[model samples]
Target: MPDTSRTQLKQILATRYAYLVRRLERITGSKEGATDALHETWLRLDKANVSTQVANADAYILGMASNVAIDQHRHERRHAHDDDVDVLLGVPDELADPERILTARRKIDSLKDVLRGLTPRRRAILLAARVDGQLNREIAERFGISLRLVESELSAAMKYCLQRMQEAGDPYTDSRSSGPRKF
Candidate 1:
């Protein structure tokens, strides 16, 4: 309400504004983000009824700027995804933490060793049964084999493949059963 108080606020803001902007820029590493952060800081300070409590106003502004930048960085980190070609080598997009990604990659590579030893026919049949969700009768009919042969072949193939995969140190192991269980 007083002219003198309004003049004092204006002077303090003008002197600290550039410093706030620069600190924000360093935190965000972008001019646009820094400008937005500065605007948000000014808005927050203006809305609060406690600006008079600020003894060292510049330090207070810088503190706000730092907190805003850290929050923004954390938000970005949460949504950041891997776009590298290495993702083609088999990385789990669900796991964003670097150690988890690296462990998933190692597991994939280890499984590949087992996949290399698998017969193409068995691999195709397994993929069709497991991934394509085909019935054993359907897979037998599609592959032109008897149902008995489908069961026998899948069992033998899975036994060999699972043994190899487990020995290769794959963290994710595929389960095997001798015959279908009625539950």
Candidate 2:
């Protein structure tokens, strides 16, 4: 890519960084959880041939950003050394393979559309609890709702997520299927 186009891509990423971060945070569940993932994503996007799509620049960027985030998460889980205590406690090693990243991006994109059918609050609450590591009381406080409401909303939200994941063949149903996965 040309220098100017690379600068343009940087500008787009810097401007839209927060939006991308928040979405990834919802998925990864923590601000730090997605920082590296997103940074790696930017590096990949900058290297790709996206300069011709200036007509829908933002969409292209967001698509690339989302894909980058998913690939990072998948890599963290798939690494053979992730089970090692020291490595596990440290940052998850990043995946630099384009093909692996592309595959992860496609699968995650499919799930993203499925997740969109949920109400904003429902999505927020579930992601906050499951991904962001927030407790029910914390979620309630964050949303300015009562604890009882968080409990109930989470109950319904978990059920909905479980059903959706089941239909989508998401690993979430197979893994966390005991507590939060209960439908």
Candidate 3:
């Protein structure tokens, strides 16, 4: 009985090979992948024991092909080919150069110096607004000051840092006639 069913499926597959391939191509998006999936489907049908009859052989065959294609895609993703490794190796390193790293470190140190130079209350206000991510109203309430005072302190602190950074030749400073640093 199973042999009879397998034979019937094989006959249907052979008769509708082109139609099945077209449908599979639409599902897999690649002609070669679709063809391979169909071939795998054929091999599976040979091995499979169909105890019950399939009501719609065409749809069953297409579903089997789709499953095979999905399995192939997952297997390919899990096992990287040599070309993939070579491509990864060919990619340029994106890390900053030593000069850029040094400049960044210097900028950080300059910022720290500027922050240290501020009055303790101003420094605390700047840290609360910037580092602590507190709202202006929240900061004002916490410090027992008016919202206007909080805003004024934050603005002054920012302006002072900008002036100090410009004096220290910060590449990012707009004060330079050459414009902000490219990097």
Candidate 4:
């Protein structure tokens, strides 16, 4: 790629970094998987042939990230580490020990408790904005509420959840803040 094109690509990448990561997470179903996919996409972008004037750098990166995610998924499926016997028996080759499972269950229960503690509308808004990837305007329209209300509820819900997570010793807590970050 030409120097100007590379610079442009870098700018696009910087601006769309969070959005791309969220998209990869939605596709791959895990933060680690998303990170791996992003790294692969970056590598591909660095080596991409751009001999012609490109249209829409954001779309190009999104397409590349999607392709990388698909390739990663295929590779994982083909080289699955689980033993053939395990697969035939419909069992995992290895499972977390009972203690780990119990701990995870406890953490999930704590998270649920925190969520249930929120007002119903706030909880719904949080789920819509975070889990369903709905914009504030979309959520406001869907709920027949004002955009400012949607934004306020979402912010409050996030802060409450982060506080709860911090109280529960969640590793996601940010050092600079009193609680976990807004995802």
**Candidate No. with top TM-score:** 3
Candidate 4 local lDDT, 1-183, one digit each (tens):
776876788777777888878877887788788778777877777788888766988777777877888898898788966687577788654667898799889888988899999999999999898789888888999999998888788879988998988988898666465543233
TM-score of each: 0.42, 0.40, 0.47, 0.44
lDDT of 2: 0.73
Which of 1 and 3 is ahead in lDDT?
A: 3
* lDDT, residue 169, candidate 2: 75
Model 1 bad stretches (over 4 Å): 1-95, 171-183
**Position 88, candidate 1: lDDT:** 70
Q: Write the per-residue lDDT of candidate 3 for residues 12-39, one digit (tens) a residue.
A: 9989999999999999999999999999
TM-score comparison, 2 vs 3, better candidate: 3
Clash totals for all candidate models: 0, 2, 0, 0
Candidate 1 global CA lDDT score: 0.70
C-alpha RMSD values across all candidates: 17.9, 17.9, 14.1, 9.0
Candidate 2's error at 100, in angstroms? 4.7
Ranking by lDDT: 3, 4, 2, 1
lDDT of predicted model 4: 0.81
Candidate 1 lDDT tens digits, 1-183: 244443555467667777667766777888888877666666655544553545666666667766766777788788756664457757656658889889888877876667667788887777777678888899899999998887877777777877887787764665743456221
Leading candidate by lDDT: 3
| TM-score computed on alpha carbons, candidate 1 | 0.42
